[model samples]
Target: MSAMLHPISRRLFLSGAAALGGVVMLHPFAARASANQAHLRLMETTDLHVHVFPYDYYADRPNDTMGLARTAAIIDGIRAEAGNSMLIDNGDFLQGNPMGDYIAYQRGMKDGDMHPIISAMNTLGYECSTLGNHEFNYGLDFMFKVLAGANFPFVCANLTKGSLAANARDDALFIKPYVILDKTITDGAGQDHPIRVGLIGFVPPQIMNWDARHLTGKAMTRDIVKAAEAWVPQMREEGADIVIALSHSGVGPAQYEENLENASLHLAGVDGIDAIVTGHSHLDFPGPKFEGMEGVDNAKGTIGGKPAVMGGFWGSHLGLIDLMLERDGKNWRVSASTSEARPIFERVDRKAKPLVESKAEVEDAARDMHEATLAYVRTAVGKTAAPLHSYFALVADDPSVQIVSQAQTWYIADMLSETEHKDLPVLSAAAPFKAGGRGGPDYYTDVPAGDIAIKNVADLYLYPNTVQAVLVTGAQVKDWLEMSAGIFNQVEPGKADQTLINTEFPSYNFDVIDGVTYRIDLAQPPKYDPKGNLINEGANRIVALEFDGKPIDPEQKFVVASNNYRAGGGGNFPDIGPDKVIFQAPDTNRDVIVRFIVEQGTINPAADANWSFAPVDGATVLFETGPKAKDFIADVKGVAIEAAGDGADGFAQYRITL
Candidate 1:
């Protein structure tokens, strides 16, 4: 592999890893190769989120489906067959797992300290990278300290910083807006030639809104398309042959929205771009998952007439874009392109088998930091009287979310005590982040009864969203619950053995509000869509809502403690927006839960059973949860989840009777 690679090689460290050999191109663009031609393979790993090992730090177990170490092997596997290759990360490498938290909070990133993920990436030999929204989770100072340890250049055309206030100038960029690489590569005909490859990067402008604490008055963002239009032309004027966009954004609507979070599709429409490496959505492009989408040719891997690819998140897949280039008057133009994601493990008959082994060198690079992270996460934070689990989070009142709700409410109560809203009732809303869904059955959280560690807190709450409190009227609260009810499929009163959960509604969107009691009537349609738009204005799934034994008043205002995402219009719930946000806590929800556990010492991990489905005669619905849920069936308070059978992917099928 090293012999075939150029000096600017992609997989120098991958010594003996075997490529899967089968290259399935979901979308193939036709290429007319000429005598003077070269093949450049662009490899991308997006949303790594600090996953360097095939290990789940939250679960404290070795997982088969994640890690950059494993993806490094695949990079070795594929780069051996290509003439020239360049490795790039599309962003979100900083914060996700317990390792990230440990590095940020436990072991501070000082002047000389190296982040484990960056160390692993440096070992893998990444050419360039970009920033994701989560990069700012711990604050800018920490983010920059971590970035300083990276061996590769990090670029983002949209994210800019200046001594001056917010502006739209590309010159104000904190990092280089774009990097031009001068490289010599071997062509398909075994001839050496020089090529100037322009690499420009972009991040979602929503980072300002998402990470307001870190970005306010310090950094500003421009629209992705605007950044691309401004910078791609400049890169060309600097004598670049081809421009590749390291778009740390997701593929979404074709039509451009100024400062849109997911703007990769529209960014590709910008002239002067050859190809795009997209991320931030945690989905694979050119896969059937994106089939039949507007302005996207999934089969051809082209968005807006340009080759594009989005590698799956957490280093699950390495995005491969093979471009066929022909020399045209001392410049190279792409004649054809093909893109696909190569997974570390392949699933056959719903069972995953390892396709590539973890590169020992990469693993060795991260071993020291990995051990420290494990020790940090394993430190006992508190104790749980009952099991801190989420296997039954969707079907019943979950102890996992309950503890988070308790923590948020506890934190917000003190924050509001001196304020005018102190007299008003406080409600906390939390969601089950690990409930079985597209992540499959093993995705559910199951923290055993005993000492609870910081790792357990991560399992209880997966996101890094900070605590936020919003003031809303009773009517708005009802509407919020109605929006949450969209997680369920409308069930006929007399139906039997019907699927009840709406697979489209993410488990994280199913907010369980504490302090107020309500019942979800499954027979009625959801008042709001999953995105929180009022679809059926008159529909009300929240049959009965009461506070302190009294029915909720539409005019009365109450403060609901929740995450920043929810208060910042994430769920699009009615009367919930940045304007309505009354309090913004600096601590992340995960930290709040940790603090709550510490303060309590020995905490009761029990849901109060404040919410449940309204009983309907002769109604039976089927749902699936992690197989571990069977052990705690008797502990569920409100819902009757009778074990029906063993479900696919190691799930336990349950029949809910009403």
Candidate 2:
């Protein structure tokens, strides 16, 4: 057997005399022995979002909770046990945290100098990676530049380049459909056996909606299932033995009506896909069994009788899928498989402190980069007079969201001041970017009243979304909010509903236009398309739309403030298109938010009584919450908590009422 890796054996020497004294070390040999018995070990790091070093760029602190550093430690440990192991990332790698922004904006990615993510990834020796939708947040050119730094092949079957020349250029380094890995594995008899492993990658087709501007003419995306159908057979024809689908997509049941919207389950059923590795919803799939159907041997971690896994995001967990293969007269067949999503570090407190110590070599490799990244992110960008928080976003008008709305409005007003349509009223729509979920409880942005740094700006707007303002009629504006209201499910007047809204709906997509006052009648169904078209029979949910205390004029054209993605039809909302786009600002939303704070010097973005729940005065609604929110329950009037209950992903829940 190969030597085992001890990921947490580094000595934590105290300052002074203790530093020279003999150190106490935890033996990792036992852990290594346990893992070595597996035939083949597969490791996954998903939703890295450009967090190269373990440090949190947004907080400008040593965030032991997230970072590829800890994942590297786990990978090293696993590799020590099983000499033959593969490391793969499930995507969303390009944009999310501040390091991504720093590299994109400050240190422009060049051909040679390693992009931070690529730099760290190269150190860890990643085998291959797929594209997540967020990778398109930056334009294709920028994406190409950043990807150039990676040493491994970038695989995705759905995306296609425009010209044959471009396609040829991309095909050289960027693999279309998949790539085949010919590896040698050692058997119990200490003999080396050759294995042909084929890996196919897929991204959601919704990239067309999420990044239309960048992809419109330069590239195109196909549906995941269609892409798989076309490419998997090609991989099989290439004489590959085992086929694994690395889906930067996610798993969900077939919603007959919204079939094409999410493609995980549909893609899983595609022929030629032996095993599945999924991501992009930031979900953790400890095993192959999804949503109750269990033909998959999750204990073996196989999908459709093959091994599969999906690692949790932000370096929180490292997905380990072990497979046992039986020799089939010169080929190998899967005998058994098991999957587990293991956390690199456990949380010891509310501050996201790390409980498990990192391996010395991994820590040493990342220490300098982590410190430098932290120092770079901590430089003050501006200041704020109040503690910005997203605590009230889901329930009512929130100051954090108000600041974003203000930034959008201010930015759009300047950009539209000289346009021919300058006379039109300008309204801004912004959502809570830092609302907590997969990011954990402390994920919410809460910058105290003081000097706000670049890190703080990142916490405010996690993505590097550019600012865009679009011209639309009052009716279209109403339609936009109506689409946003789809996040909430209709609740009966006195029903004991435990869920408040589909938590699956991303908080950033739930735009709350600050200049408009509109009541969302929960009884009605969503009237607009995710692509912004009006469904004729859809319910009129945004009742009594008003601007500045008066009913909105249907024919009146107004400029609506939004991020570049939405103004470019990212959310599939109505009447928001490039044609209706009157202004496209160069500044990112994070920059605008920071500038707004600096210009105000002191901000009081308190919510005005513009909109409220209609006559739910006596009705109660059950809502789930995190442990961190327990302190804020007093702020919600007439709210009550039932006995505390377990929520998804280790979150705590409480029932509340109006």
Candidate 3:
């Protein structure tokens, strides 16, 4: 509804907050269109993942950067600024944090139950929504039950039931592949015209692999681009004036590969698709994040020459695509367009500053359930003798990661006691989930020493992945460690003041396998790239690897405990997939951790110094973490680190001498 959009910020106003007053009268389009021209504003929220309140249940604190209740203000303000607008959700609303877990695991959903997220969404004027991979985490029945409470209809073209029919359209799909909404458009001249708007939805095809346990034999999926090619043309043939795709995928190269997860770039090339609403990568479009991607115009927010937008995840931003439509004979064509992700808050001085307040109506809708979720997460489960934090998880063997490893090892050891691999050594693979990457500087976990609660446990393990154990040879374990060591960059011998951690490498993929000792030599090149691709074949960053006071034999087998995501090929790590998995427990990893903690009553989760960095001989490097890391710098073992200064992007910088 903004009349003008700033080039750099993509904000509606260059000066004051005039649009905050809400709902303005019909104004002239920014392009100054003729009487036949109309301006349509499309607003979207994606990957919300059950965060309806501006609160972090894990931290038990109010979070300004998250929550749809806060984003609802931005939505209301922008809709008031635009004369014509339609709101839609890009999916992933079913699961994410403790509130979702509390509802799915603790509070059961009855036939007519209303989920907190759905209740909050119903208050907002959403025309349609799509399915995200996380929606299947609770199984299809629970997902459909939650959707039944939504006020708007749901559409997903790619996800299907049973087996694939040779003709994609003829397949018995889980939901209607697409829907056409007949809407009235208001032109610049204040004239009204009837228009047919077609909206289609698509989820990543990888869901069949990622959620194989829930989807196998029950559901199937088609290639996103192929599905778009088959359905968009039919949508046009069905008297659709304009087609908009609600793609719950990320922006990748314009590579037309079948069953590719991030296929939004190629999906844009499909004929008859006018615009796209993209998400699932948790990034913002018209932002610097995707500026270098092939066929993506970050400034103009176009993918493969088609206008697109991906709102930041966790309700941080609202995706907006403003299209100036021109009448092309009997049909309307987009003459000019501008897209942006408007944030509800900004990071100033490493702290969250609210840009928009929570909407009263949306907050009221989710008020009761929000309190219930908080109560559920705050229940006392156990206690810890020492603090648990992941500030130095990437740099050293950390207690936060150690506790998860201990829990996993304990649970898996018992589960396999009666199995064929009972005699094999049990090792647990754990990673630092909240090591402060895209979640900002405050993302690190900090659970104080004392009584531990469900929220603290949830904070330690962010995802809802199930526990799994895989059997692999010693050589495969070394390869796995090499892949994990990719998180660090290769350093020149005796080079001072060099950077250490590779920011591109996600911390979750940096798995630390317990029950073994190893050394990561930064002097050698990494064997694997950040995307888990083999780069240096002969590189041996994981040197001096040993087990039980002896060098590990390459042929000897061991059972490693991990989550379903890693065991089911989520990160593309070598020699780690479903075939290698020997046992799959029905319990979630978070639940396993909780059970371990309860059994211990009060336990110490101290790091065992199982891993360390090989001395680089007077080499010094820079490391970054949350500012709060300064308080526990002395707790880091076997490394010489000192306060360096502030780093870019609001992170605290430190110098490490190896």
lDDT of 3: 0.86
Model 2 spans with C-alpha error above 4 angstroms: 1-38, 163-174, 255-261, 287-306, 347-355, 359-372, 380-399, 407-452, 458-513, 517-545, 551-658
Candidate 1 global CA lDDT score: 0.83
RMSD after Cα superposition, model 1: 7.4
Q: How many residue pairs clash in all the candidates, one count each?
A: 2, 11, 3
TM-score of each: 0.74, 0.62, 0.72
Whole-model Cα lDDT per candidate? 0.83, 0.67, 0.86
**Which lDDT tens digits does candidate 1 get at residues 354-412?**
77788898899889989988897788867999998888888778899899899999989
**Candidates 1 and 2, the one with greater TM-score:** 1
* Cα lDDT, model 2, residue 203: 77
Per-residue lDDT value at 579 in model 3: 93
lDDT of 2 by residue, 1-658 (tens): 2222112223222311122223332223222323113266678888887765666566555667777766665665555545456788888887776666666766666666666677777777787888888888778878888788887877888777643233322332234568888877655555566777788887776676556667777776666777677778877788776777888866654442232544666677888776677787566775333545544444545555556677877777788776666666666655566677877665555566553455445455435545665666677655665566775566666667777888888877776665587788888888887777667766676666667776677767777677888888888888788888877766566555536666666787888888888777665655654444666455877887888788998888888888877887788776677788766554568767766766776666655535555544445555554566655544433224453566667566665564
> Clashing residue pairs, candidate 1?
27-299, 27-300
Q: What value of lDDT does candidate 2 attain over all alpha carbons?
A: 0.67
Count clashing residue pairs in model 1: 2
Deviation (Å) of 597 in candidate 2? 7.8
- Which residue segments of model 1 deviate by more than 4 Å? 1-17, 21-34, 163-170, 383-398, 407-450, 457-512, 519-544, 547-550, 553-658
Provide the lDDT at 258 for model 3: 88
